[model samples]
Target: MYYIGIDLGTSAVKLLLMREDGKIENVVSREYELSFPHPGYSEQNPEDWYRQTLDGLKALVSVVDPKEIGGISFGGQMHGLVALDEEDRVLRPAILWNDGRSIEEVRYLNEEVGKKVISGYTGNIAFAGFTAPKILWMKNNEPELFARIRKIMLPKDYLAYRLSGSFCTDYSDASGMLLLDVKNKCWSAEMLKLCGITEDMLPKLYESYETVGYLKPEIADSLSMRHDVVIAAGAGDNAAAAVGTGTVGRNKCNISLGTSGTIFITADSFCVDSNNALHAFAHADGHFHLMGCMLSAASCNKWWMDNILKTDRYAKEQTGIVRLGENHVYFLPYLMGERSPWNDPMARGAFIGMSLSTSRADMTQAVLEGVAFATRDMYEAAGSAGITPERTMICGGGARSPLWRKMISNILNISIDIPACEEGPGIGGAMLAMVADGKYSTVEEAAAAIVAVKSTCEPEPELVKKYEERYQSFRKLYPALKTVYGEL
Candidate 1:
């Protein structure tokens, strides 16, 4: 049997074809555009996502025997608000998770509504990017459009709904909306009231591996696949990526160094941080996980190397740096503001302690180390909640850098493993499809059988010690600059 995993990302929809035996047969990607209608606001059309996904599926299924295909699933960008009217037309371009238009709404939720009350109800505080804030933004600014909202959906759920004609979502993706009563895996009534929405607007929730329904006859015919192709309720991009890296069950960890950085740690039981610093979300494996995200991770390096330094050879830039933690130069990677621990939109990027003698190598090293230090900020927050992992699986574009990987390992004082296949969320979405098709017994079984760790990066004791001190200094810079960020 065969399965297809669709990774609906911000830029493209990546389709992966995998056989039951764990071999990836074919992979294809189709790009889409993200529009910034105004500064700090991001949007995308749902029609574009569905159109490209259908095209990508045709290309993916064209190579293999159609009869061998079993099921399909998705791993998608989380927290984008997709709304539909009574007749099922998209109400507006989806307010993407990265959109910062909800600044006033976010403040109202966090301050006026009270952070403690929010944390108590939903196990998370409001962020400009979360679905609830975006819903509130629409409610306040676009009341006529808001009144027509009959259904509220996430990015991938829109694809699933269009495919199976089932209005469904997975627990993993729903958690990011700031609407789920995460511990209980249900929508929070209080949150619904706060956003002036009701339970009827929400979709049915399922585990990431559960099959929602089968493909529609027309979709199946267009892709030349079996009509029995099961449509599994897929996960958020990070959760699916974690599952792809085999970060399932208790005490498992995965770090993704893509455009954004995340530390995903899975658990057997539900737990929430006091301040809700780390997200308490249901995992893809029918359990729970805590995630801490840094808004800019590898993107920080990309901005420095491509825009500032005017170079595309990233490896060549890293070769000039010699020392890991000794540089006096420090960078605060709040270029896109920030999310996780500090939900401050006023936070801005800054370079601290730069001197006349600081060389180009020092500045470059600071960017790399700055991301590591920021990642460690979340690592510490996870530890505060009594969750700690001895080792973590690492993936994404930045993970390819040996120096960056080593810096992460030493700074966090934990071992980092590299997977043989860096297919990421696309592979994880496929793995969920396999499980939903009955190719695997459970998410853990699928991960154990399919995911392979090819190498490990271990931290040296002396380097870890040096980084521990540097991280201490790094933590103090943000708070001291908090007042300054407001003035600017």
Candidate 2:
């Protein structure tokens, strides 16, 4: 038997084909358009996701007997509001997790409603990237559309609805919506009232490994797949990536450097950060985890390489950077604002301490170091909560860079484990499907078998000391320019 894991991302849908024995048979990716209709606002056509997913699925199933495919699941960007009308029509373009247009609504939820009250209900405070704030933004700005909303969903659940005809989401994905009572594993009635939405508007919730339904007949036929292919309730991208990196069990950790960066820490019990810097949420492994998410990570490097440097040669560009933690130029990676620690939506990316003698390599190095510095910010937050890992598994496109991995290891002054297969959420989704199919009795068992550490990058004391000093300086930049960000 084979299983499929679909990782629906901000820029693309990545599909993976995994066998019952845990071998990855094939992987395919398809890109889609991300729209910014207004400054700080991000949107995407849900239809684009369905079309590209179908195209990618066809390619994935072509490698093996399609009839052998046993199950399918997903891992996707969380907190994107995908509302459906009475007729199941998409109410509006999905507001992505990186969108920062809900500042006013976020302020209301965090201030007017009070963080203590909101956190009591949802175990989280409001951020511009959270779905409840987006809901309020819509209700205030697009009253007609908000009134018509009949079903609300996270991004991957929208895909599940399209393929399986099931309207459901897993607890792990729903945790970011500001609508779920995360610690309780259910919708928060208080949050629903505050957002002017009903519990009925939300999808049915399930654990990440639970099978929601099998494929719809026509949709199965479209991909030449088995109609009995079970669809598992998948996870949020970070949770799914955590599963992929084997960051399950108490105190296990994984660092993901995707479009957004995250430090994921798995816990045996529900616990919240005192300052709410790290999100306390349900984990895909049926426990709990704390995650610190930053709006931009690898995207920073991509922006510099594609938009600024105008080159596709990432490796070549990185080869010239040898300064490590010694670069005088510094980059604040707030390209799409920031989350975790500082929930400032008005924050913007900037370079500090650049001089006329600053070469292209210095600026490029600054971008990489900036992300690493931001990642460490979360690591320190986790430390304050008394959850420190001796080492962490690292995944994502940015993790492919040896230079960046070294920087991350030294910046945090911890050992970094490189997964044998670093496909991130795509592989994690497949592992969840494998669990749903009964290939493993539990998610932990599946993870132990599927996730492997290929190598470990140990932090050098000298490099760690240098980065510690650099990080202190990096930390000061955000505070110094914070007020200026709002003025801008």
Candidate 3:
């Protein structure tokens, strides 16, 4: 039998076709437009997602026998607000996870309502990117549209509903919404009341691998697929990526150095950081995990190489820096504000400690080291929660760089394992589909069978010491500039 995993990303929908034997058969991607009507706001049409996904699926399975496709699942961008009316029509463009227009709403929730109360209800403090803040933003700024909302869906759930005709979401995805009682694995009544929404307005929650429904008749016909294809309730992109990396069991870690960087630490039981620096959310494996996210990672490198430096010779540029962590210049990577330990959206990027002696290579190396140092901030937060990861599985676009991976391993003083297949969430989605189809008994079993390590990057003791000292200096730069960031 075959399974399909739809990775509904921010910029595009990636569809993967896999066999039950853990072999990927085909992959297709379809890009869509992202709209920025105002500053700090990001929006997308729900219809574009569905249309692109359908088209991508058509191409994904063009050469396969459609009747052999047993199941479908998804891994998608989390926390975008997708509102629907009573007639099931999209009420407005989705408010994306990257959108920072809800700063005031975030402040109100964190200050007025209190972080303790919010954290007690949802196991997380309010951030500008969270769904709860977006809902408040809509309610306050677009009252007419908010009043017409019949259902509130996350970005991926909207696609799931369109395909399966079932209004459902998985715990891993729902946890990011700030509307779910993450520790209890249910919708939080207090959060619902605060959002001015009822439980009925939310999708029925399921475990990420649980079967939600079958394909709708029309959808099945359009794709020339079997109507009985099981639809599994998939997970948030990060959680699904963790599954893909086999970072399922307790004490396991996965570091994603994508456009946004994250340190995901899986735990056997529920654990929240004392400072609420990390997100405590339910994992796709039916356990709990803490996550720390940095808003800019590879994107920072892209900005420097593409826009500022005016070159795509990334390897050429990186080759000039043989000094590793000994560079005197330091960079603070807060290009799009920041998340994780800081949670300060007002924070901005800066290149500190530069002098006339500083070379172009020094600044370039600083950008890469800056991201690695920031990743260490999250690593330390996980340590505070009593979870020390000796080694971590690395994924994402930035992970392709050997220098960056080495930097992360040495700076954090942990081994970095590269996955044989770095498809991340897309592959994890297919693995979940296989589980939902009973090809595997549990997510762990599927992960153990499917995930393979390609190589390992170990930290050298000497390099580790140097990076540790550099990290100490990098840490102070942010606090010293925090007050200045607020004024800016």
Candidate 4:
């Protein structure tokens, strides 16, 4: 039997067909437009997502025997506000997870409503990206639209609804909405009241591997598949990516350096930091995890290489960077503001300690090292809370760079393991479908059986010592600039 994993990303819907044995048979990506009507707002058409996903599925399964395709599932960008009217039509463009337009609403939830209260209810404080704040923003700014909402869904849940004819979301994805009582693994009435919503507006929540329903007959027929194709309620992108990299079980970690960056640490039991710095969300493996997200990671390097330097030769540009931790140049990786420890949307990217002697190589090296240092900040935060992971699986586009991986390994003083395949959430979503179809018993079992590590990068003691000094200085820059960032 075959299974399809749909990754509903910010830019596209990536569909992957995998055999029951975990071999990928086909993969297709369909791009869509992302709209930004305001300075910090990000929106997308939910209809575009469904249409592209349908087209991608048809292309993905064209070569396969339809009878052999058993199930479909999704791993997607989480916390996007997808509101529907009484007849289930999209009410407005979806406010995406990266959208920072909810700063005022976030402040209301985190400050006026009190961070302690939110932490007590959701195990997290407010962030501009969270769905609840976005809900508040909509209610206050666009009362007419808010009044018309009959259903509220996350990004991937909308895809699941279209495919399975069921309004549903998984625990891992719902955990980010600031509406779930994460510790209790259910919706929080207090949060719902705060957002001027009811529990009925939310989708039914399931575990990541649990089947939501069979595919809608019409949808299945269009793709030449069975109507009874099981649709598993998959996880948030980070949780799914963690499953893909075998970052389940206690103390396992994964670092993603894609358009955005994240440090995911899985735990068997639930835990939250005192400052609510790291996100306390449900893991796809039916447990818990702490995540620290930085809004920009590999995108910084992409901007530097593509937009700033006007070159496509990333490898060649990086080749000239020799010194790992000895460079005096420092960069703050806040191109898209920041999340995690700072939670400051006003923060901006910066380059400090640059002298006349600094060359192009030094600046390039700072970009890589800067991201590494930011990751180390998350690592230190996790350590502060008694969750110490000695090794981590690195994923996303930035992990492909050998030099960057080496720098990360040395700077963080941990083993950086590269996965056999770095497709992240897309692959994990397919694996979840396989598990739902009875190919595997548990997420852990499936991951342990199929997740393979291709290479391991370990830290050098000398470089680690050098980075230790640099990190101390790097940490100070943010504090000194905090007041200045607000003014800017």
- List TM-scores for all candidates, in order: 0.98, 0.99, 0.99, 0.99
Q: Provide the clashing-pair count of each candidate structure.
A: 0, 0, 0, 0
Off by over 4 Å in 1: none
How big is the positional error of residue 147 in model 1, measured in Å on the Cα after superposition? 0.9
Pull out the clashing pairs in model 1. Answer: none
Every candidate's CA RMSD: 1.1, 0.9, 0.9, 1.0
For residue 221, give model 3's deviation from the true position in Å.
1.6
Tens digits of per-residue lDDT, candidate 3, 13-65, equal 99989888889899999999999998777899999999999999999999799
lDDT (10s digit) by residue, model 2, range 1-488? 99899999999999999886778899999999999998998999999999999999999999898999999999999999999999999989999999998999998888998999999999999999999999999999999999999999999999999999999999999999999999899999999999899988999999999999999999888888878898999999999999989999899999999999999998999998879998999999999999999999999999999999999999999999988878999999999999987999889899999889999999999999999999999998888889989899999999999999999999999899999998889888998998898889999999888788899999999999999999999999999999899899
For all candidates in order, the CA lDDT equals 0.92, 0.93, 0.93, 0.91
Candidate 4 lDDT: 0.91
Deviating ranges (above 4 Å) for candidate 3: none
Model 4 per-residue lDDT tens digits across residues 1-488: 99888888888888888887778899999999999898778899999999999889889999889878998988899889999999999999999988998999999988899999999999999998889999999999999999999999998999999888888999999999999999999999999999999899999989999999999998878777888899999999999999889998888999999888999998888899767889999999999999999988998999999998999999999999888889999999998789978998888899999988999999999999999999999888898889888899999989999999999999899999999988889889988988888889999998988899999999999999999999999999999999999898
